[model samples]
Target: MSAATPTAPWTRTRLRTSPGTATALFLLVLLTACLAAAFPRAVDRYEDRGLRRTLAAEAPARLTVDVTVEDPGLELTPEQRTVRVSDPVTHAAYRKIAASLKAPLTADPHESSYGTRSAEPMPALDRWLPRIDGPPTQLTLNAQGGLADHARITSGRLPHGDYTARTMEAAVTRDTARHLRLAPGKVVHFPDLDGRPISVRITGVVDPVRPSGAYWSTAPLLRTPEQRSTESQPPTHYWTAALLLNPKAAAAILYTTGRAQSYWQLAPTTDTLTARQLPDVTRSLASIANGPGLLSVRTATASDTADVGSHLGDVLDRYTELRSGITPVVSVAAYGTGAVACVVLLMAGGLAADRRRAELALLRSRGASLRGIGGRLLAETAVVALPAGALGLLLALAAVPYGRVLPPVLAATAVVLLACATLPLRAMAAHRRPHPHGAA
Candidate 1:
C-alpha cells in the first residue's frame, strides 16, 4: 500500500499555533463574556416591566359593586325627636335575594352606607370587641366580602363552620390579634344584640390592603353614641374596629338579629374577578336588584384598566406607567456596548486577515471549492469560539441568575459571536486573487 500522504495540519491547529490568532481568540472570549453578563441584566429589566404590565392588566381585582338599602327618609336618626321605628327594608331580604343569585355578590362595607353619608347619626355597633384597649375604630359585620377579600392572611387560615347555624370563626388583623393576645386556635368573646356573650375562634391573622398605608381597620367602639330607641337598629351599626365575621358569625349577629340592611358586591380574591367575567355577574345583579329590599343596585358596565390599577398599581406601573427607570436605560446600554464590542472585534479580525489569505489561497490551489473552503474556515474558528462561548455562558450563569430571558439570550449571543468571528475568513477569502502560479 502507498504510504498515506501526511494530512496537512488541520486549519484549527495552524491557527492556534500563531501568536496573532491566539491573542485574537483570547480577546474574543473576553468580549463574549462581557456580552453574556450584560445581556441578561439588560433583559431582566424588561422582564420586570412585563411583570408589572401583567399585574396592571389584572385590573378587576379591586373592582366592587354597591347594592345599598336606603329608605333615606324612613330610618330614624339619633338627633330626631320622634322615636323612629320599623325599618321598611331589612338585610335578611337582601341576603336571601343574593343567596338565590349564586353570583359573586357578597356584603361590602366601604360602599354600603354605615352612617358616614347619612344626615342622621345611627346606633353604634356594640359588644363586638369588648376586649380592645383603645378608642373605637370603624367596624361593621359583613356576610361575605368584608374580611377575606380585603386582607391577606399572615398566619393560620380563614374560618370554616356551619355559616347558617352558629357563630363562624374569624380572621383578625395583625395588630388586633396582637392587641387581643390572640393567635390561631384561640377564642374571643363578643356581645350579641341583647348583651349575651358570642364566642368565636381565631382562625388566622391578616393584614388589610390599605391605601397610602393608612390604618385599615376601625376603632373598637362607636365613633359617637347613637341615642335611638329600640324601634330603630341594634347598636351593631356603629363599630369602629373591623370585626371580620365569617358567614356563621354574620348570621348570629346581623341576619338572625334583624339588623342587616346593606348588600355589597364582593370579589373572592383580587385575581378572582376579571372584566370578561363581570358582564354576566352584573347581569345577574341587575336581575337580583329587582328583588324586594335593595333600593338601588349600582354596578359597573365596564371597569377601566387604569382605574383598577391606580388602587394597587404594580411597582413598575407598566400599565399606567407615566415613567420607568430600569428597562429603557439597560436596553440602551446593552446595545451601545454590543456595537462597541463588534467594532473592536472587527479591527482584530482585520489585523489577522493576511495570514488567513495565504492559507485560503493554498487551499484553493489544491482545488478546494468555495463551499468546502468556507466550511474549513468555520470549523477552525469554532475550535476557538465554541469553547470561548461556553466559558462566556458559564460566566453569565454564575453572575446572573437563570430564568426568563437567559436561554434565549445565550442562543442569540452564540449566533452573534459566531457571526462576528467569521469576518476575518470572509474578508481574506474574498481578497485572495488568482496568481501566476495558479494559487487563488
Candidate 2:
C-alpha cells in the first residue's frame, strides 16, 4: 500500500466529538426552561372569560321587588274534576250551570263526602283541588315592561284582546301538559285572584327552566297565568326586576347601595362554592322566613360573579407574590441542576477534547489558525446540538397541554439550550491553554 494516507481529523472523527457532547448538554437545559415560560399564558387564557364577567357584574347595581300572593292557603273543594270534558261529574255540571255562577259547586248532588284517597282503579288525581268550570281569562300587556319597568316577559303574550271566553283564562305551554298530566288538547286549571276558576289552552313551549343548581331565574312565563275575565283578575303583581349599571358602578354598588336588600362576594378562581353558594345565600336571606336584614348585599352581572376586577386584582396580587417567591427558588434549583449536568458534560467533552489536542496542535503548528479550530468546534457542536434542541422544542410544543407542572420551565430551558448551542462552542474551543510540550 502507498504510505498510509493522513486522514484529516475532521473527516476521521464522527459528529460525536467534544463539541457535539457540549451541544447536547446545552439543548437538554434549554428544554427545561422553555416550558416554564408558557405555563402562565395557558392559565390566563383559560380564565379570561370568567374574569371579564366578574368585572362586569362587580361594578355595582340594585333590584327591588315586592311579592304578594292572593291566597297562600287555598282550600280543596268537593267538586274535584279532571280535564276530561265527557265525564258526567264535570261536563254535565259545566253545561247546566249559569253563565255567571259563583263558587262551591258540589262533587255530586247525591255524594255526601269528599275522599281524596286513591281508589283501587285509579290513583288520586295528581293534585287534589277544586275543578275549574271553563276556559281561562287572559290579560295581554300592550306595553313593554307591562307592570314594572324592568319586568322581562319570558313567554306567552299574544296580542291584547285575542280571545273572548265565558270562563277565566290563563296561558299554558306544552310543558304544562306534562306537569298536569294532560295532553295538548286537554284543559288545565288555574285560580284567579278573585278565586274564580280559569283554564288555559296549552299554547307553546320553548327553552326549559335552568337546571336546579344554577343561578338565574328559570320560571317559564313572563307573567303568571291570567284569568280571562278582566273584571275578575287582580292587578298584576311585580315579582322581580333586574337593574343595569356600568361594571365600575356595579362593583361599588354591591357594597354601598342596592334595593335588593342583600348580596355576597363570590370567589373568582376555581369553579366551586363561590358562584353557587353566594347567590343561594342572597336568596335565602330574602326568603319570607328570613328577614331582609340578614341579607348581605351582592353584585349581579350577566357575567360570572367571581370575575369582578377587584377579585382579579386580589388573585393577581397573591399570584404575583407567590410566583415571585417560586421563581427564585426554581431558578436556583434549575441553575444548580444545570451546573451539575454541565460539569458532567464538560468532563466528557474535556476527555474527547484531550484526545484530539495533539492532532489539533499539529495542525496549529502548521498553517491552521486558532480561529480554524474554533470554527471546527462550532461546526461539530451545531451538528450535534442543533437537531437535539430543535427536536426537544418540537416535542415540548406537542406535549404542552398534557404536561403537569413544568411546562413553563421546559420552555425556558429550550431557549437557554439554543443560546448555548449557537454561541458558546467558540468560547469552549478558545478556552484551551497552550500545551507546554511539542505537538504529539
Candidate 3:
C-alpha cells in the first residue's frame, strides 16, 4: 500500500507530533468564535436594558391611557323637557366604560383611576366665618379612586364614603390647605347653580407622596392649585383646587353639580416591560389610538362621544425611532469584529499549511489526489474547530442569559465554517504552485 493511503492515521500522527500548533489553533478558534457569538448577544442585552431605562424615566402622563366623558346633565325627554340620568346609573356606566377600555392592555394597570369632577368651579366660602372675607377661591368637587395609596394623611383621617350624610366628607392637599388657610374639621360651603349650597366637611389633609407621579398626573390641580385672573374691571385673582372625596361619593358630586367631567386612566407598569415586547406594545397602542382597537373599545363601551387620548403611543414611537437609529451602529461593530476574526483565522491556517508543506509534497509523490489531501486537512481542522466553536457559543449563552438564540447561533456557525475551510483551502493553494525543487 502507498504511504499516503492511510490518510486518517497520518492526520492523527501529524496532530500528535505538532501538539503545540494544534493547541494554539484550537485556542485561536475558541477565542474568535467566542467573540463572534458574544457580540450580538451583548447588543441584545444592552437594548433590553436601554428599553427598561427609557420606560422608567418616562412621566406617568406620557405612559397612561386616558379617557374623558362629559355628562352635560341634559337628557332629551318625550315631554319636551330636560331630564337628568340617575347618579347611580351614571356612575355604574363610567365604571363599565373604564373596565372596557382597559381590557386590551398587555401591561397591568399600575394605577386605574376613575372619577368625576364638576365641569365649572364653584365659589368656596368658610361656613364658620361666613361674613369674613378672604382671597377669592373656587373648588371643583372631585372623587377619585386609589387616593389613599398615593397620598399620606398629615392630619385627621381619610374621607368616609357616606353617601347618606347631609355634608360630603372631603380632603384637601397640603398646598391647598396652606394656601386657603383650611384644616381638618373645617366645613366649607360651595354654592351650587341651584339656590341650595353643597356642604363639605374637611376630614383630612393629604400630602402626595409623588406629586409628579402618574397617579397625581390624573388630577394635576389636586397637587398644585391653579391661580387664574380674569380680565374684569377689577382683575379678579382667584385660586382653583380640587376637593378629594371617596370614590363612593362620585355619584353625589355628579348629583350636586348636575354636569361634570369624568376621567378613566390606565397607567402601565414599566418594571415588567421588555425590549422584545416593544413592537407589540407599539402596535397595540396604535390600534387603540386610530385602528380597530379604538373601534372595539368604543363599541364595547357603547359610548362614541368619549374622548380617548394617550401620550403612550407617542412615547413608544419615539423609542422605536431611537432603537432603529442604534441598530445599524451595532451591526457595523459586529461585522467589523467578524472581519478581524476571519483575517486572524486565515493567518493561522497559512502558518499551519507552511509547517505541513513537506508532508503534503511527500503525499503528492505517493500519487495522493489533491481532493484526498484537502479532505484529510478538512477533517483534522473540523475536529478542533467545531468543538471550540460550540464551547464558545455555550460560554456566550452563559454570560448573557437574556440574549436571543438565533443571532449567537448564526455567529458561532460562521466562525466554525471559516475555521474549517481555511486550512484545506490554504494547503490546496500552496501545492497548486509550480515548485523549483522537483522532489515530487
Tens-digit lDDT track for model 2 on 1-440?
A: 68998775672274434455555555654454434354443544334434344434442111111111111112222121111111232222222221111121111121111001100011112243222333222112111111212222245432222222223222232333233333333444434334443343433232323212111211112222212222346533221112112111111111111111111112222222232133343343233113422121111111111111112334334434555565676568657765665554455456556666666666665656666676776566555555555555555555555323355545555554544443335344643554433634
1-440 per-residue lDDT for model 3 (tens digits)? 66755455866876898788778878988888788888877887787788778877887777787766676333434221111223344445545544443323543444556667777777776533322234557788887767778799999999987754247889999988887677999888866556576788889999988787677865678677887776876766777778898876666665464456766676766665667777677676777667776776555434576667888878777788999998898778767877788899998898888877887877776677789889989988988888999999998888778678998899899989999998899888878743434453
Predicted structure 1: lDDT = 0.45
> Which TM-score value belongs to model 2?
0.36
Candidate 3: give the clashing pairs. Answer: none
Better of 2 and 3 by lDDT: 3
Q: How many Å off is the CA of 178 in candidate 2? A: 15
**Estimated TM-score per prediction?**
0.50, 0.36, 0.80
Candidate 1's C-alpha runs over 4 A off are 45-122, 125-139, 142-239, 244-247, 253-327, 362-368, 405-421, 437-440
- The parts of candidate 3 lying over 4 Å away from their true place are 1-12, 72-105, 127-135, 164-166, 207-212, 229-237, 323-329, 364-372, 428-440
What's the true lDDT of residue 400 in model 1? 64
Model 2 whole-model lDDT (C-alpha atoms): 0.33
Q: Write the per-residue lDDT of candidate 1 for residues 276-299, one digit (tens) a residue.
A: 344444555455444322322222
- Which wins on lDDT, candidate 1 or candidate 2? 1
